[model samples]
Target: MAVHKVSLDEFEEIEYSIIAIHTPLEDYRLAYTLNLILELNLSRSAKDILIDIKEGKSFFSKYTFYDCKKDITWHLIQNKNEVTQRNNKKKATLFFDQNLEIPAQTYLLPELKKADFFLKIEACHNNFNVTKTVAKMNTIATINMVYSVKTETIKSKNNLIF
Candidate 1:
C-alpha cells in the first residue's frame, strides 16, 4: 500500500481583490454613495467585524453586497476602529479621584494604516475586472482616492477573508 498526502496550502488559497479607499465621509455615507454610483445594493451587516483589544472589543463598520449572478461577494470595511479605554487606577488627589479616558485606534490592516476603508471583492470565478472597478470608484466625488491593493504584499491578508 502507498500513502498519499495532501497539503493544506492548496486549501488555504483564496481569490480576492482589495481596493483601498481614502475618504472623509462617514462609513454609511460612503456606502450609500458607492451603492448609487456602482449600482451595488450594499447594506449594513447585522454584525460588525470585531477585534479584541487590551481594553475591550473594538468594532469596525462593515457593509456587504453579494452578486449572485456574478458569484461575487463585496465587503466594504472601515480600516480604523476608534476605542476609548478608561484608566481605573486613580492617583491620590486633593479631593476626588479622576477617571481618565484614553482614546485608541485599531486598524484592520496595520500595514495600510493610512487607508480609511477597504473594499474587498471575493469571487469564485475570475471574471471581475479590478482595474475597471477602481476607475469607476474614482469617479465618485466623495471618495478622495481609490486604488487597487496588491493582496500579495499584505502582511495581514488573512484578516480580509472574514
Candidate 2:
C-alpha cells in the first residue's frame, strides 16, 4: 500500500453535518425568553423542526448577536409565521449576509462578543422549529471544534489585556 500524507489545509473545506452546542445555562434562558436568535444562512425545512436536543448536536455557530436587548420582541415567538411556513414548504431560502452587533448588556462573558469559532460551516438556523426566529440565536458551541487557538492578536495600550 502506498502511504500518503494529508495536510491541515486539506480539511479547511470540510463541514460538519451536525454539531453539539452549549452556552451558559442562564444565558440560554434569557435569550430564549427574549425571542432573540442568531442570524445565519439557512436552507428551508418541511414540517415543524423536529430535532432532539438530547442528541447534543445542533446548528449553532460562532457569530455575534447584536442589539438583542433592543430588538427582543414577543412576536418572534408568537408563531403563525406565514413566511417561515412558506419557506419550509418550498424548500428554498435566501441568503442573508448581514449580522447583528454583539449585545453589550449581558453580564455573562461580556468581553467575548462572538464565540471563538473554527469549523467548516455550511449554515445553521433556529427558526420556528426551535421556538424563535433563527436570526436571534448566538453560537456558544461545545462540540466538533477540532482546532485550537494557535495565535491571538495582541493590542497594546501599554502591553496587557486578555
Which ranges of candidate 2 are over 4 A from the true structure? 13-25, 37-162
Query: In model 2, what are the clashing residue pairs, if there are any?
Result: 36-136, 37-135, 37-136, 37-137, 38-135, 38-136, 38-137, 66-101
TM-score of each: 0.90, 0.19
Model 1 C-alpha lDDT per residue in residues 137-156, reported as the tens digit of each score = 99998888999999889998
RMSD of each candidate? 2.6, 21.1
lDDT values of the candidates?
A: 0.90, 0.25
Best by lDDT: 1
Best model per TM-score? 1
Model 1: ten consecutive residues of lowest lDDT: 7-16
Q: What is the lDDT of residue 80 in candidate 2?
A: 11
TM-score of 2: 0.19
> Mind giving the per-residue lDDT tens digits that candidate 2 earns over 42-161?
222222222223222222212223234333212111101111111223333385434333221211121222332221122232222332222223333422222221123212111111
Model 1 score (lDDT) = 0.90
